[model samples]
Target: MTLLTKLKKSNINRSEYLFLENKLAFLTTEVVENKYRNSKLVIGLLGFVSIGLVLVVLWMQRKRKGLPIVGLSRQERNIQGLILQGKSNKEIANELFISISTVKTHITNIYSKLHVSGREELLQKLQN
Candidate 1:
């Protein structure tokens, strides 16, 4: 017999060859499954990133509009500006040369229009 034929016969074993075939099949299947799972993970990460970007865009749009950003009349705007300077009712009255009671009324009106509870909250609302 030829050297190549003799070598092939010496190397061949039916049971060992079948076992190796089964092992290779299992390895191939595992590689394919891992690739599929990796692709799914990549898709999932991209989905989350897209959703996060959309939310950020919406939030930025809202921020650009400012806090509530509703239009204000001249008087309300002036009162709100004065209140932001830590002005008490009497202090605002002295500054505006109005009655203390009128200043209190203006403060109440400002709180109502701003939908806030107190002066500190009002100032915070204006700032951010």
Candidate 2:
């Protein structure tokens, strides 16, 4: 036998050795089970937090209802204001010191952003 086992055999009685061994085994099993349970709880909590954060971000990103003006840039907002005042594209171009094509492009971008096909539709949508 090894020196350690020979020492244990000399120092410890059979009943005492068996009781110590059983206690150690029980304690080790309890530790393993507790660790497993703790790790699972931590993982489950992290999963819920991750999903909750994703849901909050998605909720915040949703498009605002009733007022589409928030989506327009300053220049686009200016163009929209002029359009509301019954100005023609040429008039808007001259007033804004931009080319007529630039005005048309702005108007097109505004139309797309506002989801309108024409000036009348734009006015009607903005009214509601």
Candidate 3:
């Protein structure tokens, strides 16, 4: 039988079917739109996180590169330079306007960092 004849036999009117069909279409469209919006939001968040992670990695790499290039602080490096210039610890202390004990501490720290035992070893290491 034709669809309208079947509908009539089932006691469902054409207007009712049309109304239900329109409602279903509107609901389906709303569901599809919501899914698209949700997916777009997820993708945007992922993109934002990815960019943030990349920037963080780059910043860490830059900081790491700057650190190992000179493991000594400004004062320690200056102390080493003065020592290399053949200045005695007392002379270095006098020139740098620090105490002799502080000069000794800087020397100890330099030796530990450079893996040297004394001024001779430090000079040898510097030459190499």
Best by TM-score: 2
| Segments of candidate 2 deviating more than 4 angstroms | 1-10, 63-74, 94-97, 111-125
lDDT values, one for every candidate? 0.76, 0.87, 0.85
Model 2 steric clash pairs: none
Query: Candidate 1 vs candidate 3: which has greater TM-score?
Result: 3
Instruction: Write down the lDDT that model 2 would get.
Output: 0.87
TM-score per model over all chains: 0.44, 0.68, 0.49
Question: Please, what's the RMSD in Å of model 3?
Answer: 8.9
RMSD of each: 10.0, 4.5, 8.9
lDDT tens string, model 2, 12-55?
Answer: 78887777777777998999999999999999999999999999
Model 3: residues with Cα > 4 Å off, grouped in runs = 1-10, 69-128
Query: Which stretches of model 1 miss by more than 4 angstroms?
Result: 1-10, 67-128
CA lDDT, candidate 1, residue 4: 39
Candidate number with greatest lDDT: 2
Q: After superposition, how far is residue 102 of candidate 2 from its true place, in Å?
A: 0.8
The sequence of per-residue lDDT tens digits that candidate 1 reaches over residues 16-121 is 6667667777998999999999999999999999999999999998776545436566666776778777777777788878888877777777777667789888
